[model samples]
Target: MSDFFIDIIDDDGADQGQEAEVVSGSSSTWKIAIIDDEESIHQVTRLALSSMVILGRPIEFLSAYSAKEGFELLSSDDEIAVVLLDVVMENPEAGLQLARRIRQELGNHNTQIILRTGQPGYAPEEVVITEYEINDYKTKSELTRTKLFSTIYTSLRTYQHLVAMEQSKLGLQKIIDSSASLFQERSIREFSEGALLQINALFNIHSEGIFCISSGPLAGDRDMIVAPLEAEQHRIVAATDIFKSYFGKAIDDIDDITTKQTLHRTLASKEHQFTNKYICLFLNTPSQWEGAIFIKGDIDEERLDYELLSVFAMNVSLGLENTKFFTQLTQMAYYDMLTQFYTRHGVIDRCLNTAVKNGEIFSVCILDIDYFHEVTESLGFEYGNKVLVSFANRIQSILPADSVFARLHSDVFAVVVFDDKPLDMEFIAKQCAEAIHVDGDKLRFGVSVGVSQFLPEDNLSGEELLRQAEIALKLAKEVRRGGGQAFTPSLATESRGRIQLLGELREALASHELVMYLQPKVSLIEEGTVVGFEALVRWPHKEKGMIPPNDFVPVAERSGLYYELDMYVVEACCKILSEHSELTRIAFNLSANSLNRPELVDDLENLLARYGVTHDAIVMEITENSMAKGGIVIDTLERLQSKGWLIHLDDFGTGYSSLSYLLDMPLNAIKIDRSFLLQLHDSDNAAVLLKGIISICKDLDKKVIVEGVETDSQKAFAMDAGADVAQGYLFYKPMKLEEAVDLMKKQS
Candidate 1:
């Protein structure tokens, strides 16, 4: 055993006398060499140490008649820990030269050297001890058995301490290096296992054991223990017993579980005979662990385990805590908030990896809700959210176990089927649409599915697959009714055109690529006189011939690019109306999404207030179809009216023309649908319906305007039906702001 190990065992042992004897015995086994020209001195030193033994090993003596013999003995056996030499051996400086040569020439730093002499008068104690590489000096007469034994023991103890310190330094360095790589571990099991190994090694403890506390899923698993061989079977048995005692019990009993506090104390009080074979060098109180390391040797006799374990416990706690936090955070980042499914980014990452490995044949399907925005506008955002959530749940319920779903955006979702089966993919898509039923009100959504198969060694990533599926979805949407459209490479060419249009759309609002056209609302009393103008939004694409608002409006809303467009439109209206003070008040229409914004009223008020425009001058025309069913739509419209802005109910007869809203709404004007006028000559019902609408308006004290009049007969009919104003292509088609002003001047 090393001298350092002996000292630790000695100091740490509770039985002081027994521990001292053990330490002495253990130290005595280290060989001690004596070099002098005297045989009597060696015999005397051996007698001094004869009674001492370090553990079971006894100290043996080697006597040398000259320095040459001492050097030869030390050279042959490297285990010699100490050398006692005389300064005046064969010559006065011979022993001094040997000491220097042993350290410098032979590189033998392990051996401890003690200089002794018959005459100390020649070499003083301070000079011989310092100038030469020797431990101590003693006179021949002072070399009694007790002193000699004391000197040797003290020297060995000092040497042992230095070796131990060096080992501890290296261990600390390894711990620092190991701790840095903790995050790189693949699994919690692997991380815990590696940490235990590093911690035990750091303490220079070959006998320690570690185990984790089992909780929740691991409740009954008692065999889950991590430990080294030195911990022995007793620790394992004790741990199993400890676990079973509290396995199903509440955690409140954890405080009073120590054997030392209860079992050992009781045994001692009763004077009962007990053996300590199972006791270990873990004298310090054991910390509670779902798991723990049990030491089996005399813990009070060895403080190394206790002190080292304290440090290990701190490191392990920090590592485990970090692992848990990172693992949870990683999961949350990859999942969708509403569906608890993989997000577009997460699904794409998984697909790309699968494609790279070329293992399973993966197929991707893109599904879009048919006219979903119409429902959102009609039923309200709250109901729309419910429908979306229900859609996700239904897909999860019916999809194959191997398939995965992701919400790509508002109305578009993607599902990746593992098996390359087109029939299965189509069935799942249809099931998702059909399952969204709410009693009498089954959801009215149609799904367009796009199918594409995974290719081996495909440079195409998830992003490319999404693009291909989107192309197929576009083809499906073009069909009007619900159906599946398989992806073809030729579709990518048409997709490129749409992508290019999208890029231009991004700059459309910013660059004023979108132009407002004013359509004249001419008076029925006189053909040339204009009553009002309807503001229309038109996007003129540089590459594609004029892209209709219907084609791009939904796209803008889906991409969250509608807010910018809405803000720009509101701001532009403020500027345009601020210049047009001559014509009757112009009305600009807003989408349901814009009206639902809590900040819409504030934003609109601020813009008008900035330009010094009165609420009466600018009319906010919201379609009845859009605002009829949304929760906050009525409240928002009332709030705007309360702020003194005129609200016009546009597209009056198209959808959900609630009589209650027509009677109760705080609207300034209502535009009659032109369908009644087109069939005025053909049907008497059209005339009767128009008269009923006119009578309702007259009763409500609201002004009436009629749209889509293309001839003199329709305009005259509107004027004859108690309509206050009339507008259509016969008056003027939508024209540019400047052109509308010119036409107004001409009419005036």
Candidate 2:
């Protein structure tokens, strides 16, 4: 050890490289503090070891003339790695006391202390060194320049190793905790943040830094994670408190352009790049999102950063990729594939979950694209798809931030808005109408809107709220030009009543609670002579004495029960015709809904054949407006005409009457509506209008029936107008189907 120290302190100033290496062990500098009473002791110590180097660093000295001064000097500076103390200072125990103060009062366990004594009997090397926690003990006679260097070198090296071990313990612990969080965490932003936290702990860096992800997906990446952003740009994913404003900002916007350029190069090269002052590592995960981990700090970590930080980057990158995978999976499950809106099931499922607050209220609105099927059929589904997307975007732009939207069906969209303030559904409906019309107006289309609100008090599911809106939407579609309507109490009441009626009607059909009434239409020339009877359905309920046709028929039409009712009437009329061969024909009514049936011809033909009745024994009556809405009404009517099933334009002079009905529609007769006949006594114009209508029918070689003639004067007026048939109470009243059958039997 003595020869080694002697060689380290070469007096010739030889081996400068060896001197530099032998001083501090590194190119870095280590500070040493010297404490003694004699000025010569401090000078000699400086001269011997000032040029010494350890760990590639040279030694720097700080001196104190007294024990108290030494304590004060060491107190101000903590980086002093080693303290060389003389035992005989201002007092015999001065160096020992200073050592005790450094260990106890200053609480610095890291700085090495070397104790030396000039007197042997005053203090034993074992006693003072053991008692005061001194690092080493030597006498002035033995501490030559070589021995001094050996002592200083050994002490400094031990101090460096101890510090490295302590730092490694703290840094490794922090890293273990951080890695646990990385594996357990799910957010890319949070994972990136933890990366910076662990990096700061490991490298002793406290400056602000940004973690940026600003390149295309990495190799072997099948998912286009960042393709949705404009031109696949890069973004700052996470940052420290001081740099938090940089989050979500583009990499080009970073104030540190040099750092930004370096990150770009690192991403381009797919490798790490280090500068004299900055540390940046490129993270390549097998996903489309590339990242750059950067730090501009007080300490340079480049020496061991690749070895140490590479672990952190690998763990963090895997965590980030997993997070992105989960995020995309969730988006695909909950969002509409075409418009990026919420799916109906997705919104409903979310609402049914525990995420909603206990007392939260939401207003739900539904928008329907008017004649959407027509648009899709005429313009093609591709154009219709564009219209749907455009309409959705417009609605999203019009609604508030917290609103949730979804495409519920092919042409229907559902929206849910939080009710933070007093909900004004009318205003929401208006906004919805406006949004729909922007595209609708250009395309010559229209839309209807209906709105309802969530009322937990009502105990309605999200689906029920949607149903309420649909009921209101049905009413809106009937309105002119198809406008907006909010779900009011009246709509709910009407819907409830209709639903109840539908249920009762279904029950009545099963139980045979419904019966038929026949009103006879007699010729004016043949007094009190019954000819043909019109079939009128009557529902006699146990609860509500009688259900009128006006009330129940409309409900049946709206509820799609009209088809059943029409079939029931046809069967009843066939039974009557099968009983009495003398009956001329029974005319049955056809509503717009029933007239649109695709299987109407098949049904009627089967019924006639089953009952052994000719098609000539039945006359089908329809109002003028009913035919306008059914696309196949004209074709079906022509088919019926060909089969000798007489088609009559019933209530023709009142509803949707057109000259086209006389010229184009196949018709055996026109029945002037009851209104014209009722006004005959008071309004001369009504009488003149009736005469002209009858005249037109005569000119067209069509039969004219004057219906609802309740008085002798109405009958006389009908005869004067050249009517071929008169259906009025003045001739024959309404009778039961059995009574009509008996009368027909009697006539036969």
Candidate 3:
């Protein structure tokens, strides 16, 4: 051991019989405990710290004779900010034990401990400093006054930093708690209000703010709205104390034009703006829903999350997005895509909520554009869309805001008007129909309205109420009524019978109970030789007798069951071809719905393979309307032709019979519609049209088939027009497979 120096230190760490210099700074003292067995070490520590000050605070040293005494002092009083200790004290490892006790047992991690050793080799300073949690390691002789004061100042600085961090952590926790509470609010108003409050709490600063939304879809072509309406549409969803009265109000409605322009500009740029007057953070809500927070204060947000308002702004954005999405989803659940009016489902929802539950009198008027199909046929779909939009705008504009208007079906609008007293449904229907009849350009097309009233004592569901309205609509259209017809019990009975017929029809097709009848197509050039057969589906009902093709085909097509019916006919044709080798080729008709189905190709492949039939044995007769379905349908025809199937453009004289489809499609034949053959009796225009069609087909190297040849004159007319084949009742009416087989065998 080095020769020990002795100098006594009192309890207050004052040197005995030695005057110590004092610092003049009047600040709180940093209590530093000196733990050592040697009195000389404590005396030297006190002398070094005697005139020293850190952060304007004077240093105070507490003297301990041994490690045990230092532990007792630190345990009783937590004010000791630093410990200057000797490792080899009363016990060789006593200082080490006390350092561990002060840090671990006393849990005084905030205080700094320095380990001093008289004999440098007694214990390794590095090991003692690390294991015992000592802040600094120094031998007694090396601890000069300047070095000791520097160490104490450095340690004091570290302790002050820890306390400041603790304060910040508590403050951050408060903000987290506030932000977490915001999610529970459902509406945008409540959510933004909560978020604004949290932002204020985050900074502990008072500020005014508002949330605005620019309306549009989150993810769609934003151009759906007219450009003029884009900037004109925005609303304040929430606001601070200053703008509270304007919550849920449109931005345009506010008198503050400057603020409105600022908001619009901010929404347009999608950027945050910060200045002394205010800081604006754009909350990027999905779709065109533009929202932001405007804080009116000079805030130094360095203590908070560096971008303090951004967090609450983001929360408000997400929350408002969720609420708006849900709101739009609710609207869409009951509204039409094109008109922004309620659909049939929407009307039903309204009825369930109000009309059905209350005793108030309400009438539903079902209106339709008269001769709408002709409108679409004469003009293209673009013009038709314009017509629909115009009609919806006119009707909606004329009706009271309280009235529920919905697009119940294509070209049909259902309006439910509410009245306290009993409604004269007929007068109401007439007035509504006249409104539509004079409604803009739609007046040229005219309109028919059907009125239905809720009958007392009959608890009707929304579906039943709408069904009654539909009955009236059909009645008015059929009768060509001046305005509309009111619903009657007889119409409901008729509708029920139709429904029953539809159900039976579906069952008959599913069970293959319906029979396939063939109408012979004879070669006009050969005079009597049978060339091919047209397959026609016949529904022979047990009770109702033979149901006319005119009856169920329209109903089936209207109800979206035409594809199934067409597919069934194709399957029957394939089966007939497979069953009879004499039947060389079968021509069958397919509607627009069947043609557009993407699965048609796959389904055809599977059906042909299942029946072991070749594609060449089948002829697909598509209507003129199907040709207008654009390139996809034409492509399908080409693909079918490539696979050896013959494509015939049936009803070729009707609809948009563009020379384009005739040239573009892989057509094998053009079947003249019955209208052209019938029209010949009225004028030579029919003869001229038929001859032109045949000449076109001839030039294209395609076959021509004339239908509706009922008399010898008509057949002669067709042959003269260069028709290769003719099929009509005058040759042979539609016959079942057995009859057709016998007729074919006789002819053969």
Candidate 4:
């Protein structure tokens, strides 16, 4: 092996292209401390070490006759990577004490120490090496020039490895912490801001920049940049301008888009050797969130940073892509992409299709925009589409719990109202008509609604019932602007008899024929836990055993009783809960009517307060149908959260349930529709679907309630699938409120 001085020479050589200062000729400089009473010993030590060349550099030996003088030299200069000590100096064993002080008091872990003792007995090799933490100990006579170089070489190399390890550990920790913090931030802006701060601290450079780009029409368009004052202006300019310009065009391309190479090359600049950029392109479609491009300045302190930068960029890109994917998946499944309303398909699957065994009365209402086609032509298709979405949003806000609202057709929307009292469908329709007005202040156009009471006759099919309401809607339009018509047999007696019935159904809810029923949700786990009960509305015709909600719920909502129906449901639920305080709690299904009311949340709060029920115990089940339609639903749900109601996204995996709901709403639990569970046995993808739902709910920190588990296998599957709660025939069907209370007492 080369002499110890040779290794330092190799490292400090100008050829290394590092910050290495030259102290002498080709000979390497060594900081040697000579401590001896004899001046000759100092001279002799210097002469011997001077001739010794480690690598291409000759050693420059330091000399001191006393330990005190040697300490002074050591204290003044820390560049002495290695120190040589003498055992006998101004005081015996003085060298040994100094070595201990260097290791303990000075806390210098990088410097290497070697002790040379004239009198070896003063400090034994074993004792000094173990107790004093000195790297090496040698008798003066035995330390030849060759042996001395060997010992120094060993100590310096060990120190180098230790320093490298410490730096590696620190770097890894910084990366982990930054990644974790990014995941915790709620918005992209917040994540970017946090990352900027962390990267600045980690690199110890004032210059930091973040430029993000979103692709496509639906995606957000923005640009932001931030940097420290001390950071070079030219560096920022090159990084920001060059990097952004390069990625901007590349990311703009709709076909064959990628973040690799094309964008990464632009990040190369004077301040940094190489940089990494990533592009995540979202699929072209109607969605809340879309494509994203992230570019980061790369500072390569280590020679291996090229690969690390690539890995970092890849990770960031993947995260952004995953978020966008989740968001789009939710929208397609839960909402009406065109008008941002609950699609007809989603509402029926989640809300209207509930397992209603006993005869129950629900109300149905259908409303059509008056002269919508003319409005579309006059306003331009794009503006018309916007107005339609906006109009749907307004009407959606007023829907009540137990009511499912949806855009049934291009110009028609349907709502199923759940209420105990007779709903004034005319008033509900008029309120919706006003909601559709443009600019909130202008009466842009009128809306006409057809109403129907859910009679057993309506149970034939959801389509037939909706058709009946549409018939009523025609009568409403015939009357005048903003006129609401309820469905009646005589109304149907006209050419568009369904339209006639819609005109009369509005009169029926006012007479109070509609009644309310409560369906109990029992919890198998957590003994005595009823969990909650669902509020169901029923209509008892003087002749029919019970009218099905499917038949009439839509009529009331479309005819304008949606808001009143919501109040009725809330009032009845409160009464039931008040009557059965010992039961776990009660939940009510809500329609767009109640949700749209500016006073809805406030009213619910007051009712809960009056009933002495805490918000925690009261859950409002909102169908994926209503959630699909955006606007007031988002704001209303947020307001309801502020008021303390536990809002649940009912029929979770069945609607346009875009990822926004997971992040935006404070949903306590999600109920898996019974259909999804039933399909589990029929389709090969049953387990996969169920597992996906469970995983999403678990990740969002919400509970999952499986709606149907009739068979033993279904129950076992639900349990194994990690369902938090189960409700079906296997447990118990929707029974009378009194029977539910009796069962709860027995279970308790």
Best by lDDT: 2
User: For each candidate, what TM-score against the reference?
Assistant: 0.53, 0.63, 0.48, 0.37
- Across residues 8-55, which tens digit of lDDT does each residue of candidate 3 receive? 223233323223232212236779888888788778778666865455
Residue-wise C-alpha lDDT for candidate 2, range 576-598, written one tens digit per residue: 78877777689988776767788
Report the Cα lDDT for residue 217, model 3: 36
What is residue 58's positional error in candidate 1, in angstroms?
30
Scored against the true structure, residue 670 in model 3 reaches a CA lDDT of: 87
**For each candidate, what is the lDDT?**
0.65, 0.74, 0.72, 0.60
Q: Candidate 3: global Cα-lDDT?
A: 0.72
lDDT of 1 by residue, 1-748 (tens): 3233444333333223232344221223668888888878877777656656643346677778787888888888777877888777788888888887787767777578887888847665466556555777777767665566667767776655544454455545444444443332222333444544453334433333323322322211223323322221112212233344432222223344443333333222422112222222222212222234332223223434445555565565565455434434444444566766666776776554556466567788877888889877888877777788888877667767767888887877888877755645466557766846653467656777887777665567677877778778878787633778888888887677656666788888768889788887766666567767777788977767788778887667655677677777777777787877765567787877777778988888899888777877778887886666567888888888888988888878887877777767778888888887888999999899998998889789888888888888887778788888788888778888989888878867
- Candidate 4 lDDT over 325-354, as tens digits, reads 543443455456686555676555545555
Ranking by TM-score: 2, 1, 3, 4
Per-candidate total of colliding backbone pairs:
23, 17, 1, 80
Model 2 stretches astray by more than 4 angstroms: 1-229, 237-243, 256-259, 272-289, 292-365, 388-408, 413-441, 453-468, 479-481, 507-513, 542-545, 579-584, 728-734, 746-748
* Root-mean-square deviation of every model: 12.8, 12.5, 17.9, 27.5
